[model samples]
Target: MTAPAARSLVLDAQALSLLLRNDRQMITRIEAARRTGVPVLVSALTIVEAVYGKTDTARLHWVLSRLQVQEVTPADSITAVRLLHDAGDLHGHKYAIDALVAAMALRSPPPVLVLTSDRDDWRKLCGDRMQVKDV
Candidate 1:
């Protein structure tokens, strides 16, 4: 049998909420990721948003189980901080959490991609540099 393919994906809070609510687009992406065996990463920032109790712990675990959950680290934090302050390029929408997620994806093994609903923000900073499939 052939070995499973490896994949890396970044999930933002909105995407997480979509996943929790059984949104079709979110479900499709999740299925695609599962089919590709790509690891899905949920940023700590998402946890902050999820702290609102909108997410069920059981479902969260299910989401996490679909792929690896890479914790957002200080290095990720530093990248976010830099991007947020990079007023020269990032423009108005380069928020802290997006930077961290982008940084984390960039630092991950090459070929990682972000599955997000917010394309504008991802497009603004990543452009063609990142592997992004936006909704």
Candidate 2:
């Protein structure tokens, strides 16, 4: 038979923050994806970045209501650490959250699209494993 359809879209912190801020483009993209029955995913690390401050509790809740939050599992954490190490040693960059986001996106099935504002880092970390949609 045919292979299973690819899964959801992953949102990085910047993209999620844009959605929280009600950016028209991001909202429109999310709405269009929802219309096509594709759910949006946000890594736990991304949530940490987006809701670091005490303000915007209501806004955080609203954003959460619109997307699925994927928790960082032990395996994901290990992979993230490895990614950080590799990038730091090779590219002179140490980005924990971005690595975690990449790990989460890579865990998903093929054809996964990651909505991100920082395209370069994600591109370096993910390579050709997933598609990065710059926002």
Candidate 3:
């Protein structure tokens, strides 16, 4: 069988951190994905999770310039709640951002790959709708 193709790439907080740090491996992966026309995405909420006061503003802006920052719509927020509820009532602050990320990924093109450290959490949130690859 042919290798599975990735249509979109979603980066969670951990992966986004690595990318912001200019990690060689992460950069290579992102470049390769871009070369193939895969949209590298970061949820607008992920900015809240990944960026902080100590972060380098110049680097942050530079990196963000290269990726797609997906805005969270009102409908997406509703979907995020449903995802949390569906995942066995996994509500509360801890799961809220992840649910949003999963919601965004679910609405993206198929074969969506999420680079995250929380593999199990993403799997639970995304179900069979998207792929979770550890950062």
lDDT of 2 by residue, 66-94 (tens): 88889888899789878766666433334
Of 2 and 3, which scores higher on TM-score?
3
On lDDT, the candidate that comes out on top is 3
TM, every model:
0.75, 0.84, 0.95
lDDT of 1 by residue, 1-135 (tens): 732343576777777777877789788887888777676777767757544556678877776676566688888877766765653445334365677778777777656677776677776656655677664
Candidate 3 on 88-110: residue-level lDDT in tens?
A: 98988889999998889988998
Q: Tell how far residue 40 is off in model 1, in angstroms.
A: 1.6
In candidate 3, stretches whose alpha carbon ends up further than 4 angstroms from where it belongs are 1-3
The local lDDT score (0 to 100) that residue 7 gets in candidate 3 is 98
Report lDDT (CA) for all predictions: 0.69, 0.79, 0.90
- Minimum summed lDDT over a 10-residue window in model 2 is located at 85-94
Q: What residue runs in model 2 are displaced by over 4 Å at the alpha carbon?
A: 1-6, 52-55, 85-94
Of 1 and 2, which scores higher on TM-score? 2
Ranking by TM-score: 3, 2, 1
Per TM-score, the best of the predicted structures is 3
lDDT of 3: 0.90
Q: What clash pairs does model 1 have?
A: 7-38, 7-39
